[model samples]
Target: MSEDDEDFAGCRPLLFTIAYEILGSAADAEDVVQDSYLRWHAVRGKGIGHPRAYLVRTVTRQALNHLRAARRRREEYVGPWLPEPVRTAPDVSEDVVLAESVSMAMLLVLETLGPDERAVFVLREVFGYSHREVAGLVGRSEATVRQIAHRAREHVRARRKRFHHDPGTAREVVGRFLSAAGTGDVGTLMSLLAPGVVHVSDGGGLVSAARRPVAGRERVARFVAGVARRSAPGTRFDITSCNALPAVLFRVGDRIDQALVFEISGGLVHGMYAVGNPHKLGAAVTPRLLSRKGHETWKP
Candidate 1:
């Protein structure tokens, strides 16, 4: 590998993680990283004191710029806009804070923040960057960054609740949910869902899905089961990790038709996010990209 490539190898994942958190899109994150790489090449041999810092700051600025422009497109989104789900390994980030920051729930909360606040909060909180570093990265004064961080932290804290994850219980619930739907037992399915459980699907208008979120256990259960019944004859569902949590991947032949992620709280499924957008499924389904586990022993 070239010197620049080797230098960036270690920090590449971190850059993507930062960009993804800021922009909430894997595809866009990759673009930011790529753009940063080109900029790195252009500045080669410039006696850059810190390449990692330079690259991260460059990527953060790119993501912030991209997000500012993309907000309009999101405003015109055809349906309830959802973050593009990406595969994450348990060890994707050595820091627990960074690892957990990408959860769908957190992403949803991040969506509500302004682009600058999101950038400040992500750099300061998620990645553990200091107020000064965050300010330099986002091109704001330390005081301004602190203000944004405070506001962002307070906003997310108001919305984000700590839900302890129990993998065993989560896997069991998800597995049983699939089995219940497969058997067309709506009652059993409803029993596994919380009363306020919501089913949100994102097809990006490239495919068919519930444009608005489907709420209520009974309603979500029915919607899930109905979609199950509509699956192709040779389809398959396998338990896997989406955004570092238990999720289901629907495979029709070799290509993935949909990626479903569930949020388990209080021993019941509280939220369901189904990504049916074909454009976004490539990263969500690549076996090499994500970690997977089977739930053959799941009982309803």
Candidate 2:
């Protein structure tokens, strides 16, 4: 490989992670990384002293631009919009902070932040970038970055309170919940859900799903059972890790029909995010490796 290629290749995982956390879409993250690489290729020979820092700055800017441009589309989206699920390796769960940062609930919270705030918060909070570094990456003054970071941190801290369950207990609960839902066992489902459980489905108006969140254990259980009863024949469910947590992937024939990721706490399911949009299923077919400390070895 050329010297330029080697430098960018070495930082691809970290770059992709930064972009994904900022953009909340693996596909878009990959695109941003690729775009960054092309830009790097064009400028690498111009006495670049720090390849990783430069690449990260490029990716952060690209992702911020993308997020700003996507706001209108997301605002107009039909039904509830959920972040695209990314299948993650088991080792990712070993890092509690890393795992929680990528969870659907966390991503949804991030969606509430403005583009610049999200970019600053992710670099400062999730990736441990210094305030000066974050300011450089996002093209803001140090004081501005700090203020945005503080505000963004406060917002995330206030809203990010799901999916802190014990892994073993969470897996067991998810397994049983899936079985009960698949079999239309409302009684068992009710026993497994929290009294205030909330279920949100995002089909993007391209598939069948609840346009609004279904709340309460009884309502969620019945909704889950009803959906199961309406599922087409030959549908298969595979329990796997998504965003470093246990999740269900529903397949129809050879296509992924939906993904169900739970927010488990107190040994019971408290929040459920069902993503049925086909556009967001790319990660389900091919898991992406993630790293917070430049340790990821997965290519593509």
Candidate 3:
């Protein structure tokens, strides 16, 4: 086996972890990891030790570059921008880490940080990298890295109370949310939402959506009930896990029309991310029951 191949294999998991932390989108994270590998190979013929650290640095830098551009684009975004949701593996050995690293709430909060600050925080806190290591990776002095990380920490701490939902409880809450939405039951939906729950939909201007985030249980409930009515007759919905939390997927005539990813806190729905853009649905896989052509099936 080539040295580069061995090194890449050893660092794949860590690379995904770092990318996910920085970008908060599994699809984007995978793209960044692939890009990192290409860059690694381009320089592979050159002798280098500590391949693991080298890969980490390369991936982290690529993620930071993406974050820089993403931040600029979001400033003028049509509406609330949300991180892409991911489906968790059934066995969640890293549930706690995922809670902190991949939560929708944490990712949204990360949007407040500068690219460099986000990189430093992810490297030091999420990956356990030392200040010196982060400094070297980010091309900053150790003291500067320390300061950036500290500032990022304070920013995150200010929003910590907003992300205190247990993953298990969040799953149950989402299930109830889907049930309420499916039956067009406003009371049930209102009961599940926190008094000040926020609903942010990203139709990307291609479809109808709120121009800004809709806050308050009554508003969110009314919006969801209206959505339930527009769904094509015989349309089916399922509550599935996405991005390490529970989410609802709407299927119409075999095509997945929408996926509603959420953030729960204090046993109530605290945040709502509705992804209706067809482009965003590219990563969604067909459910097993619908695999066969003409099957016309949907399952929760």
Candidate 4:
């Protein structure tokens, strides 16, 4: 490999993560990173001081552009739209801030922000970039970037609920939910669910799922139990992490039918995002490596 290739390769994980956080889709993030690499290759000998920073700026711009275009597509999307779930290494959970940044709930909150605000927030809050650095990355004035950051922070903090369950609490709740769901135990399912529990399934118009969110503990419990009881023969469930949180993958043989990630607060399930879209499920076949620092293998 050429020196230029190696240099950009070294920054791929960070670049992919930045794009993923902004767009909430691994497929789109990979495309943006590849396009950035092509652009980076075009100006190899231009004496760029820091290839990492240069690639980051390029990827950020590309992702922002892609996001603006995607808004129209999402408008016409069928059923409830949820972010594509990506698998992460277990160590990612050790960093509470990093884990929350990629959580399904947080990603949904970020979806409400404008493109520029999302870019600024991800760069500044998630990646630890300063106002000046973020301004340079997003091509905004430092003062303007600060305002955008403040506004984004307030918006996020207002909508985001604190997830206070420890790993053991999460595991126990998930285990019980799975058992009750599999056995069609509606009463037990309701017991484990919060009073206002909500279940959202993203079918992407290609599969069968609820077109809107299912709310209330009883309704969600019945829905979950009904789905489980109707599962195809030989169906199985795999416990794993989706976006660095406990998740269950429903599978038939080797093919995954859906990926459900839970939101546990106070030892009760408050929310669940089930991604039944086949396209979104492919990215989680292998866990992607992520880091707050810019050094790790680019692809996993």
Please name the candidate that would achieve the greatest lDDT relative to the true structure.
Answer: 4
lDDT of 3 by residue, 132-250 (tens): 98998888999999999999999988975446666678778877777788789999999999898988897877767777889999999999999888878888777776655667777
Q: What is the per-residue lDDT of model 2 for residues 116-188, given as tens digits with 9 covering 90 to 100?
A: 9999988998888899988899999999998999999999989987657787899899988888987899999
Question: Each candidate: how many clashes?
Answer: 0, 0, 1, 0
TM-score of each: 0.92, 0.95, 0.85, 0.95
Q: Is candidate 1 or candidate 3 better by lDDT?
A: 1
User: What is the Cα-based TM-score of model 2?
Assistant: 0.95
For candidate 4, write residues 1-300 as lDDT tens digits: 997688677788888889998998989999999999999999878987677778888999999999999989999999999999998777889988889999999999999999999999999899999999999999999999999999999998899866766777898899999999888999999999999899999999999999999999999999999989888899888788889888888888899999999999888999999999999998777788876666443321
lDDT of 1 at 82: 85
Instruction: Give the runs in model 4 whose Cα sits over 4 Å from its true position.
Output: 296-300
> Considering lDDT, which of the candidate structures 1 and 2 is the better prediction for this target?
2
RMSD of each: 7.0, 2.6, 8.0, 2.6
What lDDT tens digits, residue by residue, belong to model 1 across residues 1-300?
Answer: 986677676567777888888998888888998999999999978988777778878999999999999898999887878888887654543444654687788999999999999999888887778899888899999999888999999999999845556778888888888889999999999899989888999989988899999999889888988988888899988898778767899888889888998888778988889998887776685532221111222111
- Which segments of candidate 1 are over 4 A away from where they belong? 92-95, 287-300
User: Which is the winner by lDDT between candidate 1 and candidate 4?
Assistant: 4
Between candidates 2 and 4, which one is better according to lDDT? 4
The C-alpha lDDT values of all candidates are 0.82, 0.87, 0.73, 0.89
